[model samples]
Target: MKPANKFRADTIRRLIVFLFLFSAAIVGFGCSQPILESNECIEARDPVKRFYSFHFGNEMLASKENIEKRKKYLSKRLNAELNDRSDTKFDYFTQTADYPKAFRAGKCDSTAGDRVKFEVLLFWRTNEKNSQRAIQVEMVKENSRWLIDRVESKE
Candidate 1:
Protein backbone atom coordinates (compact mmCIF):
# COMPACT_ATOMS: atom_id res chain seq x y z
CA MET A 1 0.00 0.00 0.00
CA LYS A 2 1.20 3.58 -0.67
CA PRO A 3 2.56 5.46 2.38
CA ALA A 4 0.24 8.45 1.84
CA ASN A 5 -2.83 6.17 1.62
CA LYS A 6 -1.78 4.40 4.82
CA PHE A 7 -1.38 7.72 6.68
CA ARG A 8 -4.85 8.91 5.55
CA ALA A 9 -6.48 5.65 6.73
CA ASP A 10 -4.80 5.93 10.15
CA THR A 11 -5.96 9.51 10.56
CA ILE A 12 -9.52 8.60 9.64
CA ARG A 13 -9.62 5.79 12.20
CA ARG A 14 -8.38 8.14 14.93
CA LEU A 15 -11.03 10.69 14.01
CA ILE A 16 -13.74 8.06 14.15
CA VAL A 17 -12.60 6.86 17.56
CA PHE A 18 -12.56 10.40 18.94
CA LEU A 19 -16.05 11.12 17.66
CA PHE A 20 -17.39 7.90 19.19
CA LEU A 21 -15.89 8.69 22.60
CA PHE A 22 -17.23 12.25 22.55
CA SER A 23 -20.72 11.10 21.73
CA ALA A 24 -20.61 8.51 24.49
CA ALA A 25 -19.48 11.07 27.03
CA ILE A 26 -22.33 13.38 26.12
CA VAL A 27 -24.87 10.61 26.49
CA GLY A 28 -23.38 9.47 29.79
CA PHE A 29 -23.58 12.94 31.31
CA GLY A 30 -27.13 13.47 30.10
CA CYS A 31 -28.27 10.20 31.63
CA SER A 32 -26.63 11.01 34.96
CA GLN A 33 -28.64 14.22 35.44
CA PRO A 34 -31.03 13.99 38.37
CA ILE A 35 -34.67 13.25 37.65
CA LEU A 36 -37.25 15.13 39.69
CA GLU A 37 -40.22 13.16 40.99
CA SER A 38 -43.61 14.32 39.76
CA ASN A 39 -45.54 13.72 42.95
CA GLU A 40 -47.03 15.32 46.03
CA CYS A 41 -43.49 16.10 47.10
CA ILE A 42 -42.97 18.55 44.27
CA GLU A 43 -46.52 19.87 44.53
CA ALA A 44 -46.14 20.64 48.21
CA ARG A 45 -42.68 22.12 47.88
CA ASP A 46 -43.26 24.64 45.06
CA PRO A 47 -45.29 27.25 46.96
CA VAL A 48 -43.07 27.21 50.01
CA LYS A 49 -40.27 27.79 47.54
CA ARG A 50 -41.87 30.99 46.29
CA PHE A 51 -42.53 32.14 49.85
CA TYR A 52 -38.93 31.53 50.75
CA SER A 53 -37.68 33.41 47.73
CA PHE A 54 -39.55 36.51 48.91
CA HIS A 55 -38.66 36.36 52.63
CA PHE A 56 -36.48 39.47 52.82
CA GLY A 57 -38.56 41.04 55.65
CA ASN A 58 -39.61 43.65 53.11
CA GLU A 59 -41.79 40.92 51.65
CA MET A 60 -44.95 39.90 53.48
CA LEU A 61 -45.68 36.27 54.07
CA ALA A 62 -49.14 36.87 52.74
CA SER A 63 -49.93 40.09 50.99
CA LYS A 64 -53.23 40.78 49.27
CA GLU A 65 -51.58 40.57 45.85
CA ASN A 66 -49.39 37.56 46.55
CA ILE A 67 -52.25 35.74 48.21
CA GLU A 68 -54.34 36.27 45.11
CA LYS A 69 -51.58 35.03 42.82
CA ARG A 70 -50.86 32.06 45.03
CA LYS A 71 -54.50 31.35 45.78
CA LYS A 72 -54.51 28.32 43.55
CA TYR A 73 -51.72 26.82 45.63
CA LEU A 74 -53.25 27.68 49.02
CA SER A 75 -55.95 25.88 50.92
CA LYS A 76 -59.13 27.77 51.81
CA ARG A 77 -58.37 27.37 55.48
CA LEU A 78 -55.34 29.61 54.97
CA ASN A 79 -56.96 31.80 52.36
CA ALA A 80 -58.42 34.14 54.93
CA GLU A 81 -57.79 37.89 55.15
CA LEU A 82 -54.28 39.17 54.39
CA ASN A 83 -53.25 41.17 57.43
CA ASP A 84 -49.58 40.27 57.89
CA ARG A 85 -48.17 43.17 55.93
CA SER A 86 -45.31 45.25 57.34
CA ASP A 87 -43.05 48.01 56.04
CA THR A 88 -40.04 46.62 57.85
CA LYS A 89 -37.39 45.38 55.46
CA PHE A 90 -34.40 43.22 56.23
CA ASP A 91 -32.43 44.08 53.14
CA TYR A 92 -29.46 41.79 53.20
CA PHE A 93 -26.22 42.63 51.45
CA THR A 94 -26.06 39.10 50.16
CA GLN A 95 -28.03 35.84 50.30
CA THR A 96 -25.60 32.95 50.71
CA ALA A 97 -27.99 30.01 50.55
CA ASP A 98 -29.03 28.18 47.41
CA TYR A 99 -32.64 27.50 46.52
CA PRO A 100 -34.47 24.55 48.00
CA LYS A 101 -31.79 24.20 50.69
CA ALA A 102 -33.74 21.02 51.55
CA PHE A 103 -37.22 19.54 51.40
CA ARG A 104 -39.12 16.41 52.47
CA ALA A 105 -42.67 15.19 51.86
CA GLY A 106 -44.96 13.17 54.12
CA LYS A 107 -47.84 10.95 53.15
CA CYS A 108 -51.27 12.42 52.69
CA ASP A 109 -53.57 12.30 55.74
CA SER A 110 -56.93 13.03 54.15
CA THR A 111 -59.10 10.19 52.95
CA ALA A 112 -60.10 12.18 49.88
CA GLY A 113 -56.43 12.44 48.83
CA ASP A 114 -56.64 16.22 49.06
CA ARG A 115 -54.11 16.99 51.76
CA VAL A 116 -50.34 16.64 52.02
CA LYS A 117 -47.59 17.94 54.26
CA PHE A 118 -43.97 18.85 53.68
CA GLU A 119 -41.09 20.79 55.13
CA VAL A 120 -38.59 23.09 53.45
CA LEU A 121 -35.38 24.73 54.58
CA LEU A 122 -34.44 28.38 54.00
CA PHE A 123 -31.47 30.48 55.01
CA TRP A 124 -31.05 34.19 55.60
CA ARG A 125 -28.36 36.48 56.94
CA THR A 126 -28.42 39.83 58.72
CA ASN A 127 -25.32 41.86 59.68
CA GLU A 128 -25.55 40.39 63.18
CA LYS A 129 -25.88 36.70 62.25
CA ASN A 130 -27.15 33.98 59.93
CA SER A 131 -30.47 32.25 60.43
CA GLN A 132 -31.94 29.01 59.16
CA ARG A 133 -35.56 27.95 59.32
CA ALA A 134 -37.45 24.80 58.49
CA ILE A 135 -40.96 25.70 57.56
CA GLN A 136 -43.80 23.20 57.65
CA VAL A 137 -46.21 23.58 54.78
CA GLU A 138 -49.66 22.04 54.65
CA MET A 139 -51.03 21.59 51.17
CA VAL A 140 -54.40 20.63 49.81
CA LYS A 141 -55.64 19.77 46.35
CA GLU A 142 -57.96 22.36 44.89
CA ASN A 143 -59.18 22.09 41.30
CA SER A 144 -56.62 19.39 40.69
CA ARG A 145 -53.64 21.56 41.76
CA TRP A 146 -51.75 21.41 45.02
CA LEU A 147 -52.07 24.58 47.06
CA ILE A 148 -50.53 25.70 50.33
CA ASP A 149 -53.10 25.93 53.14
CA ARG A 150 -50.84 26.77 56.01
CA VAL A 151 -47.20 27.49 56.75
CA GLU A 152 -45.31 27.89 60.02
CA SER A 153 -41.64 28.28 60.77
CA LYS A 154 -40.29 25.38 62.76
CA GLU A 155 -37.65 27.73 64.22
Candidate 2:
Protein backbone atom coordinates (compact mmCIF):
# COMPACT_ATOMS: atom_id res chain seq x y z
CA MET A 1 0.00 0.00 0.00
CA LYS A 2 0.99 3.68 -0.29
CA PRO A 3 2.77 5.35 2.66
CA ALA A 4 -0.23 7.56 3.56
CA ASN A 5 -2.70 4.63 3.49
CA LYS A 6 -0.38 2.46 5.63
CA PHE A 7 0.00 5.30 8.21
CA ARG A 8 -3.80 5.82 8.40
CA ALA A 9 -4.40 2.08 8.87
CA ASP A 10 -1.91 1.91 11.75
CA THR A 11 -3.55 4.90 13.49
CA ILE A 12 -7.01 3.34 13.19
CA ARG A 13 -5.75 0.05 14.67
CA ARG A 14 -4.26 1.88 17.68
CA LEU A 15 -7.50 3.83 18.22
CA ILE A 16 -9.58 0.67 18.15
CA VAL A 17 -7.34 -1.04 20.70
CA PHE A 18 -7.48 1.97 23.04
CA LEU A 19 -11.28 2.11 22.83
CA PHE A 20 -11.60 -1.61 23.57
CA LEU A 21 -9.37 -1.36 26.67
CA PHE A 22 -11.20 1.75 27.88
CA SER A 23 -14.58 0.03 27.59
CA ALA A 24 -13.34 -3.04 29.44
CA ALA A 25 -11.97 -0.92 32.28
CA ILE A 26 -15.23 0.95 32.63
CA VAL A 27 -17.23 -2.27 32.76
CA GLY A 28 -14.89 -3.85 35.31
CA PHE A 29 -15.14 -0.84 37.60
CA GLY A 30 -18.91 -0.66 37.25
CA CYS A 31 -19.23 -4.28 38.30
CA SER A 32 -16.98 -3.81 41.34
CA GLN A 33 -18.62 -0.71 42.81
CA PRO A 34 -22.18 0.23 43.67
CA ILE A 35 -23.79 2.11 40.77
CA LEU A 36 -26.70 3.84 42.50
CA GLU A 37 -25.74 4.05 46.16
CA SER A 38 -23.54 6.81 47.48
CA ASN A 39 -20.30 6.00 49.28
CA GLU A 40 -21.68 7.23 52.60
CA CYS A 41 -24.77 5.08 52.27
CA ILE A 42 -22.73 2.03 51.42
CA GLU A 43 -20.33 2.61 54.31
CA ALA A 44 -23.21 2.89 56.77
CA ARG A 45 -25.16 -0.11 55.51
CA ASP A 46 -22.33 -2.60 55.09
CA PRO A 47 -21.57 -3.29 58.75
CA VAL A 48 -25.23 -3.65 59.67
CA LYS A 49 -25.84 -6.02 56.78
CA ARG A 50 -22.77 -8.07 57.60
CA PHE A 51 -23.75 -8.30 61.27
CA TYR A 52 -27.26 -9.46 60.46
CA SER A 53 -25.97 -11.98 57.97
CA PHE A 54 -23.95 -13.52 60.74
CA HIS A 55 -26.83 -13.15 63.21
CA PHE A 56 -29.41 -14.88 61.00
CA GLY A 57 -27.14 -17.58 59.69
CA ASN A 58 -26.11 -18.84 63.10
CA GLU A 59 -29.39 -20.45 64.13
CA MET A 60 -31.10 -17.05 64.22
CA LEU A 61 -29.46 -16.17 67.50
CA ALA A 62 -26.70 -13.88 68.66
CA SER A 63 -24.99 -15.81 71.36
CA LYS A 64 -22.03 -14.63 73.34
CA GLU A 65 -19.70 -16.46 71.05
CA ASN A 66 -21.16 -14.86 67.94
CA ILE A 67 -21.14 -11.45 69.56
CA GLU A 68 -17.47 -11.78 70.37
CA LYS A 69 -16.74 -12.81 66.82
CA ARG A 70 -18.60 -9.85 65.38
CA LYS A 71 -17.62 -7.26 67.95
CA LYS A 72 -15.63 -5.21 65.48
CA TYR A 73 -18.88 -4.29 63.76
CA LEU A 74 -20.34 -2.96 67.03
CA SER A 75 -19.65 0.27 68.79
CA LYS A 76 -17.78 0.14 72.11
CA ARG A 77 -20.85 1.09 74.13
CA LEU A 78 -23.07 -1.39 72.35
CA ASN A 79 -20.51 -4.14 72.73
CA ALA A 80 -20.22 -3.47 76.47
CA GLU A 81 -23.99 -3.40 76.86
CA LEU A 82 -24.40 -6.74 75.17
CA ASN A 83 -21.72 -8.22 77.39
CA ASP A 84 -23.14 -6.70 80.58
CA ARG A 85 -26.65 -7.97 80.08
CA SER A 86 -27.31 -10.96 82.28
CA ASP A 87 -30.23 -12.29 80.35
CA THR A 88 -29.28 -14.67 77.58
CA LYS A 89 -32.82 -15.17 76.33
CA PHE A 90 -33.16 -11.71 74.80
CA ASP A 91 -31.03 -10.25 72.02
CA TYR A 92 -30.43 -6.53 72.31
CA PHE A 93 -29.75 -6.08 68.60
CA THR A 94 -32.94 -7.73 67.42
CA GLN A 95 -34.79 -6.98 70.67
CA THR A 96 -36.37 -10.40 70.62
CA ALA A 97 -35.81 -14.02 71.44
CA ASP A 98 -37.52 -15.07 68.24
CA TYR A 99 -35.35 -14.15 65.24
CA PRO A 100 -36.18 -13.66 61.60
CA LYS A 101 -34.97 -15.84 58.76
CA ALA A 102 -33.57 -13.04 56.62
CA PHE A 103 -32.86 -9.32 56.79
CA ARG A 104 -32.13 -6.41 54.43
CA ALA A 105 -30.62 -2.98 55.02
CA GLY A 106 -32.72 -0.25 53.46
CA LYS A 107 -32.04 3.38 52.61
CA CYS A 108 -29.67 5.28 54.88
CA ASP A 109 -30.61 8.57 56.53
CA SER A 110 -27.79 10.77 57.73
CA THR A 111 -28.53 11.73 61.31
CA ALA A 112 -25.50 13.91 61.97
CA GLY A 113 -21.88 14.26 61.07
CA ASP A 114 -20.29 10.82 61.12
CA ARG A 115 -23.61 9.18 61.92
CA VAL A 116 -26.39 7.52 59.89
CA LYS A 117 -29.36 5.24 60.34
CA PHE A 118 -30.70 2.40 58.24
CA GLU A 119 -34.21 0.98 58.21
CA VAL A 120 -33.54 -2.73 58.25
CA LEU A 121 -36.30 -5.05 57.12
CA LEU A 122 -36.50 -8.41 58.83
CA PHE A 123 -38.37 -11.26 57.21
CA TRP A 124 -39.76 -14.44 58.69
CA ARG A 125 -41.08 -17.48 56.84
CA THR A 126 -42.88 -20.53 58.09
CA ASN A 127 -45.18 -23.14 56.63
CA GLU A 128 -48.24 -21.21 57.85
CA LYS A 129 -46.89 -17.73 58.50
CA ASN A 130 -45.06 -15.00 56.63
CA SER A 131 -44.26 -11.82 58.52
CA GLN A 132 -41.89 -8.87 58.41
CA ARG A 133 -40.58 -6.22 60.75
CA ALA A 134 -38.69 -2.97 60.43
CA ILE A 135 -35.89 -1.91 62.70
CA GLN A 136 -33.80 1.23 62.94
CA VAL A 137 -30.07 0.64 62.96
CA GLU A 138 -27.94 3.59 63.96
CA MET A 139 -24.35 3.62 62.81
CA VAL A 140 -21.48 5.87 63.67
CA LYS A 141 -18.26 6.39 61.76
CA GLU A 142 -15.37 5.81 64.13
CA ASN A 143 -11.77 6.02 63.00
CA SER A 144 -12.85 5.86 59.38
CA ARG A 145 -14.97 2.76 59.87
CA TRP A 146 -18.70 2.42 60.35
CA LEU A 147 -19.93 0.65 63.46
CA ILE A 148 -23.40 -0.21 64.70
CA ASP A 149 -24.16 2.15 67.56
CA ARG A 150 -27.66 1.06 68.43
CA VAL A 151 -30.71 -0.82 67.20
CA GLU A 152 -34.39 -0.21 67.88
CA SER A 153 -37.53 -2.00 66.83
CA LYS A 154 -40.02 0.04 64.81
CA GLU A 155 -42.99 -2.16 65.63
Candidate 3:
Protein backbone atom coordinates (compact mmCIF):
# COMPACT_ATOMS: atom_id res chain seq x y z
CA MET A 1 0.00 0.00 0.00
CA LYS A 2 1.04 3.66 -0.39
CA PRO A 3 2.99 5.20 2.55
CA ALA A 4 0.42 8.03 3.01
CA ASN A 5 -2.47 5.52 3.04
CA LYS A 6 -0.64 3.34 5.57
CA PHE A 7 0.02 6.34 7.83
CA ARG A 8 -3.62 7.39 7.74
CA ALA A 9 -4.74 3.87 8.52
CA ASP A 10 -2.40 3.67 11.52
CA THR A 11 -3.61 7.00 12.89
CA ILE A 12 -7.25 5.97 12.53
CA ARG A 13 -6.57 2.68 14.32
CA ARG A 14 -4.88 4.50 17.23
CA LEU A 15 -7.70 7.00 17.52
CA ILE A 16 -10.32 4.24 17.60
CA VAL A 17 -8.42 2.35 20.26
CA PHE A 18 -8.05 5.50 22.41
CA LEU A 19 -11.73 6.31 22.13
CA PHE A 20 -12.73 2.77 23.09
CA LEU A 21 -10.53 2.78 26.17
CA PHE A 22 -11.70 6.24 27.22
CA SER A 23 -15.34 5.24 27.00
CA ALA A 24 -14.72 2.04 28.96
CA ALA A 25 -13.00 3.96 31.75
CA ILE A 26 -15.87 6.39 32.02
CA VAL A 27 -18.43 3.57 32.20
CA GLY A 28 -16.43 1.72 34.84
CA PHE A 29 -16.26 4.78 37.12
CA GLY A 30 -19.95 5.53 36.69
CA CYS A 31 -20.83 2.02 37.82
CA SER A 32 -18.57 2.19 40.86
CA GLN A 33 -20.67 4.80 42.65
CA PRO A 34 -24.40 5.27 43.04
CA ILE A 35 -25.85 8.10 40.99
CA LEU A 36 -27.57 10.55 43.32
CA GLU A 37 -29.86 13.39 42.33
CA SER A 38 -29.19 17.00 43.29
CA ASN A 39 -32.80 17.10 44.52
CA GLU A 40 -32.49 15.81 48.06
CA CYS A 41 -36.22 15.19 48.14
CA ILE A 42 -36.10 12.79 45.23
CA GLU A 43 -33.06 11.01 46.68
CA ALA A 44 -34.72 11.10 50.11
CA ARG A 45 -37.65 9.10 48.79
CA ASP A 46 -35.54 5.95 49.34
CA PRO A 47 -32.75 6.44 51.81
CA VAL A 48 -32.46 2.73 52.41
CA LYS A 49 -31.92 2.14 48.74
CA ARG A 50 -29.28 4.82 48.69
CA PHE A 51 -27.69 3.42 51.83
CA TYR A 52 -27.56 -0.08 50.45
CA SER A 53 -26.11 1.17 47.21
CA PHE A 54 -23.37 3.20 48.86
CA HIS A 55 -22.60 1.13 51.97
CA PHE A 56 -23.32 -2.53 51.37
CA GLY A 57 -23.21 -2.69 47.60
CA ASN A 58 -19.75 -4.22 47.43
CA GLU A 59 -18.15 -5.98 50.40
CA MET A 60 -19.74 -8.49 52.77
CA LEU A 61 -21.39 -6.92 55.81
CA ALA A 62 -19.17 -8.89 58.17
CA SER A 63 -15.96 -7.46 56.81
CA LYS A 64 -14.40 -5.57 59.68
CA GLU A 65 -13.08 -2.82 57.43
CA ASN A 66 -16.47 -2.34 55.87
CA ILE A 67 -18.22 -2.37 59.24
CA GLU A 68 -15.83 0.11 60.76
CA LYS A 69 -16.05 2.43 57.76
CA ARG A 70 -19.84 2.35 57.90
CA LYS A 71 -19.84 2.95 61.61
CA LYS A 72 -17.55 5.94 61.29
CA TYR A 73 -19.61 7.41 58.48
CA LEU A 74 -22.82 7.02 60.47
CA SER A 75 -21.22 8.46 63.57
CA LYS A 76 -20.10 11.51 61.66
CA ARG A 77 -23.61 12.04 60.29
CA LEU A 78 -25.17 11.65 63.71
CA ASN A 79 -22.75 13.86 65.61
CA ALA A 80 -24.75 16.96 64.81
CA GLU A 81 -27.97 15.37 66.01
CA LEU A 82 -26.18 14.25 69.12
CA ASN A 83 -25.33 17.93 69.54
CA ASP A 84 -21.66 16.99 69.26
CA ARG A 85 -21.83 15.89 72.87
CA SER A 86 -22.65 12.18 72.71
CA ASP A 87 -20.05 9.48 72.74
CA THR A 88 -22.54 6.85 71.73
CA LYS A 89 -22.45 5.46 68.19
CA PHE A 90 -25.35 3.93 66.30
CA ASP A 91 -25.38 1.12 63.74
CA TYR A 92 -28.14 -0.16 61.43
CA PHE A 93 -26.52 -2.97 59.54
CA THR A 94 -27.35 -6.67 59.68
CA GLN A 95 -24.46 -8.82 60.85
CA THR A 96 -24.17 -12.23 59.26
CA ALA A 97 -21.02 -13.86 58.00
CA ASP A 98 -23.10 -14.91 55.01
CA TYR A 99 -22.78 -12.55 52.09
CA PRO A 100 -25.83 -10.73 50.80
CA LYS A 101 -26.53 -11.34 47.14
CA ALA A 102 -29.36 -8.90 46.60
CA PHE A 103 -31.47 -6.27 48.32
CA ARG A 104 -34.74 -4.46 47.60
CA ALA A 105 -36.07 -1.17 48.92
CA GLY A 106 -39.22 -1.64 50.97
CA LYS A 107 -41.70 0.87 52.37
CA CYS A 108 -40.59 4.42 53.17
CA ASP A 109 -42.14 7.48 54.77
CA SER A 110 -40.97 11.04 55.31
CA THR A 111 -41.94 14.20 57.14
CA ALA A 112 -41.22 17.79 56.17
CA GLY A 113 -40.75 20.43 58.81
CA ASP A 114 -37.53 22.38 59.17
CA ARG A 115 -35.17 19.48 58.56
CA VAL A 116 -36.88 16.81 56.49
CA LYS A 117 -37.09 13.39 58.08
CA PHE A 118 -37.10 10.16 56.12
CA GLU A 119 -37.46 6.60 57.29
CA VAL A 120 -36.59 4.01 54.70
CA LEU A 121 -36.96 0.29 55.19
CA LEU A 122 -34.71 -2.02 53.23
CA PHE A 123 -34.85 -5.81 52.92
CA TRP A 124 -32.18 -8.27 51.99
CA ARG A 125 -31.92 -12.02 51.42
CA THR A 126 -28.82 -13.95 52.31
CA ASN A 127 -28.80 -17.75 52.38
CA GLU A 128 -31.31 -18.46 55.12
CA LYS A 129 -35.00 -17.67 55.43
CA ASN A 130 -34.28 -16.32 58.88
CA SER A 131 -31.74 -14.06 57.27
CA GLN A 132 -34.44 -11.74 55.96
CA ARG A 133 -33.77 -8.42 57.63
CA ALA A 134 -34.98 -4.84 57.56
CA ILE A 135 -33.00 -1.65 58.04
CA GLN A 136 -34.48 1.68 59.00
CA VAL A 137 -32.58 4.63 57.57
CA GLU A 138 -33.07 8.07 59.09
CA MET A 139 -32.05 11.13 57.13
CA VAL A 140 -32.09 14.86 57.69
CA LYS A 141 -31.14 17.77 55.51
CA GLU A 142 -27.91 19.53 56.40
CA ASN A 143 -26.42 22.42 54.44
CA SER A 144 -28.83 21.71 51.59
CA ARG A 145 -27.69 18.10 51.37
CA TRP A 146 -29.52 15.00 52.52
CA LEU A 147 -27.55 13.30 55.24
CA ILE A 148 -28.23 9.99 56.94
CA ASP A 149 -28.31 10.99 60.56
CA ARG A 150 -29.09 7.55 61.90
CA VAL A 151 -29.73 3.96 60.89
CA GLU A 152 -31.12 1.13 63.00
CA SER A 153 -31.87 -2.42 62.05
CA LYS A 154 -35.43 -3.25 63.02
CA GLU A 155 -35.04 -6.37 65.10
Candidate 4:
Protein backbone atom coordinates (compact mmCIF):
# COMPACT_ATOMS: atom_id res chain seq x y z
CA MET A 1 0.00 0.00 0.00
CA LYS A 2 3.08 2.30 -0.04
CA PRO A 3 3.29 4.62 -3.10
CA ALA A 4 6.69 3.35 -4.22
CA ASN A 5 5.56 -0.26 -4.02
CA LYS A 6 2.47 0.53 -6.06
CA PHE A 7 4.62 2.18 -8.74
CA ARG A 8 6.94 -0.83 -8.84
CA ALA A 9 4.04 -3.20 -9.21
CA ASP A 10 2.59 -1.17 -12.03
CA THR A 11 5.93 -1.04 -13.79
CA ILE A 12 6.35 -4.78 -13.53
CA ARG A 13 2.88 -5.35 -14.92
CA ARG A 14 3.56 -3.07 -17.87
CA LEU A 15 6.81 -4.85 -18.57
CA ILE A 16 5.09 -8.18 -18.58
CA VAL A 17 2.46 -6.96 -21.03
CA PHE A 18 5.12 -5.43 -23.23
CA LEU A 19 7.00 -8.71 -23.36
CA PHE A 20 3.92 -10.62 -24.39
CA LEU A 21 3.12 -8.16 -27.14
CA PHE A 22 6.67 -8.18 -28.39
CA SER A 23 6.77 -11.97 -28.56
CA ALA A 24 3.55 -12.07 -30.54
CA ALA A 25 4.91 -9.52 -32.99
CA ILE A 26 8.04 -11.57 -33.59
CA VAL A 27 6.07 -14.72 -34.17
CA GLY A 28 3.82 -12.87 -36.56
CA PHE A 29 6.81 -11.54 -38.45
CA GLY A 30 8.24 -15.00 -38.97
CA CYS A 31 4.95 -16.36 -40.18
CA SER A 32 4.23 -13.42 -42.44
CA GLN A 33 7.49 -13.19 -44.42
CA PRO A 34 7.71 -14.94 -47.77
CA ILE A 35 11.38 -15.71 -47.26
CA LEU A 36 11.82 -19.44 -47.20
CA GLU A 37 13.90 -21.39 -44.74
CA SER A 38 17.57 -20.41 -45.04
CA ASN A 39 18.76 -23.69 -46.53
CA GLU A 40 16.11 -23.85 -49.21
CA CYS A 41 16.98 -20.36 -50.28
CA ILE A 42 20.66 -21.25 -50.38
CA GLU A 43 20.14 -24.33 -52.44
CA ALA A 44 17.87 -22.55 -54.88
CA ARG A 45 19.77 -19.28 -54.94
CA ASP A 46 23.01 -20.85 -53.78
CA PRO A 47 25.21 -18.12 -52.28
CA VAL A 48 22.50 -15.53 -51.69
CA LYS A 49 21.01 -16.78 -48.48
CA ARG A 50 24.28 -17.50 -46.66
CA PHE A 51 24.82 -13.90 -45.69
CA TYR A 52 21.10 -13.43 -45.31
CA SER A 53 21.42 -15.96 -42.54
CA PHE A 54 24.20 -13.90 -41.01
CA HIS A 55 22.34 -10.63 -40.76
CA PHE A 56 18.90 -11.95 -39.88
CA GLY A 57 19.97 -14.59 -37.28
CA ASN A 58 20.01 -17.86 -39.17
CA GLU A 59 22.50 -20.53 -38.08
CA MET A 60 22.49 -23.19 -40.77
CA LEU A 61 24.17 -20.98 -43.36
CA ALA A 62 27.77 -21.12 -42.10
CA SER A 63 28.33 -24.50 -43.71
CA LYS A 64 30.59 -25.29 -46.66
CA GLU A 65 27.58 -26.61 -48.51
CA ASN A 66 25.87 -23.26 -48.43
CA ILE A 67 28.98 -21.28 -49.35
CA GLU A 68 30.26 -23.37 -52.24
CA LYS A 69 28.64 -21.06 -54.75
CA ARG A 70 30.94 -18.22 -53.76
CA LYS A 71 34.22 -19.90 -54.60
CA LYS A 72 34.33 -18.69 -58.17
CA TYR A 73 33.81 -15.01 -57.40
CA LEU A 74 35.02 -14.70 -53.83
CA SER A 75 38.22 -15.76 -52.15
CA LYS A 76 38.64 -18.73 -49.83
CA ARG A 77 38.94 -16.17 -47.06
CA LEU A 78 35.26 -15.34 -47.38
CA ASN A 79 34.07 -18.74 -46.27
CA ALA A 80 36.77 -18.96 -43.62
CA GLU A 81 35.83 -15.62 -42.20
CA LEU A 82 32.13 -16.39 -42.01
CA ASN A 83 32.84 -19.80 -40.58
CA ASP A 84 35.02 -18.29 -37.90
CA ARG A 85 32.34 -15.86 -36.80
CA SER A 86 29.53 -18.41 -36.86
CA ASP A 87 28.22 -19.04 -33.37
CA THR A 88 27.08 -22.54 -32.66
CA LYS A 89 26.27 -21.69 -29.08
CA PHE A 90 22.65 -21.63 -28.06
CA ASP A 91 22.29 -18.43 -26.11
CA TYR A 92 19.05 -17.40 -24.46
CA PHE A 93 17.69 -13.86 -24.62
CA THR A 94 14.74 -12.17 -23.00
CA GLN A 95 12.63 -9.59 -24.78
CA THR A 96 12.91 -6.67 -22.46
CA ALA A 97 12.24 -4.34 -25.37
CA ASP A 98 9.54 -2.46 -27.15
CA TYR A 99 8.97 -3.31 -30.77
CA PRO A 100 10.92 -0.76 -32.79
CA LYS A 101 9.38 0.99 -35.76
CA ALA A 102 12.61 0.95 -37.70
CA PHE A 103 14.20 -2.14 -36.25
CA ARG A 104 14.98 -3.54 -39.70
CA ALA A 105 14.76 -2.32 -43.29
CA GLY A 106 15.54 -3.86 -46.66
CA LYS A 107 14.38 -4.51 -50.18
CA CYS A 108 14.63 -7.71 -52.13
CA ASP A 109 17.40 -7.00 -54.62
CA SER A 110 15.67 -6.61 -57.97
CA THR A 111 18.33 -8.49 -59.83
CA ALA A 112 18.28 -11.52 -57.59
CA GLY A 113 15.31 -13.06 -55.84
CA ASP A 114 17.11 -14.24 -52.72
CA ARG A 115 19.33 -11.20 -52.15
CA VAL A 116 18.14 -8.66 -49.61
CA LYS A 117 19.86 -5.71 -47.99
CA PHE A 118 18.84 -4.99 -44.41
CA GLU A 119 19.35 -1.80 -42.50
CA VAL A 120 18.77 -3.00 -39.00
CA LEU A 121 18.37 -1.12 -35.77
CA LEU A 122 19.60 -3.35 -32.98
CA PHE A 123 18.69 -2.66 -29.36
CA TRP A 124 20.84 -3.57 -26.41
CA ARG A 125 19.86 -3.13 -22.81
CA THR A 126 22.00 -3.11 -19.71
CA ASN A 127 19.45 -1.51 -17.47
CA GLU A 128 18.09 1.09 -19.83
CA LYS A 129 17.26 0.64 -23.49
CA ASN A 130 19.84 1.67 -26.09
CA SER A 131 19.19 1.64 -29.80
CA GLN A 132 21.42 1.95 -32.84
CA ARG A 133 20.42 2.10 -36.48
CA ALA A 134 22.94 0.92 -39.00
CA ILE A 135 23.24 -0.74 -42.36
CA GLN A 136 23.41 -4.33 -41.24
CA VAL A 137 23.93 -5.98 -44.59
CA GLU A 138 24.06 -5.68 -48.36
CA MET A 139 23.29 -8.98 -50.04
CA VAL A 140 24.38 -8.89 -53.65
CA LYS A 141 23.80 -10.98 -56.72
CA GLU A 142 26.59 -12.83 -58.46
CA ASN A 143 26.38 -15.60 -61.04
CA SER A 144 22.59 -15.45 -60.96
CA ARG A 145 22.26 -15.91 -57.18
CA TRP A 146 22.46 -13.88 -54.02
CA LEU A 147 25.08 -13.54 -51.26
CA ILE A 148 25.74 -11.18 -48.38
CA ASP A 149 28.72 -9.05 -49.28
CA ARG A 150 28.93 -7.15 -45.99
CA VAL A 151 27.22 -6.56 -42.66
CA GLU A 152 27.93 -3.28 -40.94
CA SER A 153 25.95 -0.83 -38.87
CA LYS A 154 26.59 2.45 -37.08
CA GLU A 155 25.10 3.13 -33.68
Question: Largest lDDT belongs to which candidate?
Answer: 2
- Residue pairs whose backbone atoms clash in candidate 2: none
Q: Is candidate 3 or candidate 4 better by TM-score?
A: 3
Please provide, for model 1 over 71-96, each residue's C-alpha lDDT reduced to its tens digit, 9 standing for 90 to 100.
55456666663324432222111122
Error of 3 at 84 (Å): 12
**Full ranking by TM-score:** 2, 1, 3, 4
Candidate that beats the other on TM-score, 1 or 4, i.e. the better one: 1
Candidate 4: how many backbone clashes? 2
Residues 1-155 of candidate 4: C-alpha lDDT, one tens digit per residue = 99999999999999999999999999999788575445423443334334333424532233454345444434343445655654423211111123222233333333345445444344444456666544444455556554455555443
Worst 10 residues of 4 by lDDT: 90-99
User: Each prediction's TM-score against the native?
Assistant: 0.50, 0.71, 0.44, 0.32
TM-score winner among the candidates? 2
Regions more than 4 Å wrong, model 1: 2-15, 18-31, 36-38, 51-73, 80-116
lDDT of 2 at 105: 87
So what's the TM-score on candidate 2? 0.71
lDDT minimum window of 10 residues, candidate 3: 86-95
lDDT value, candidate 3, whole model = 0.55
lDDT of 2 at 75: 87
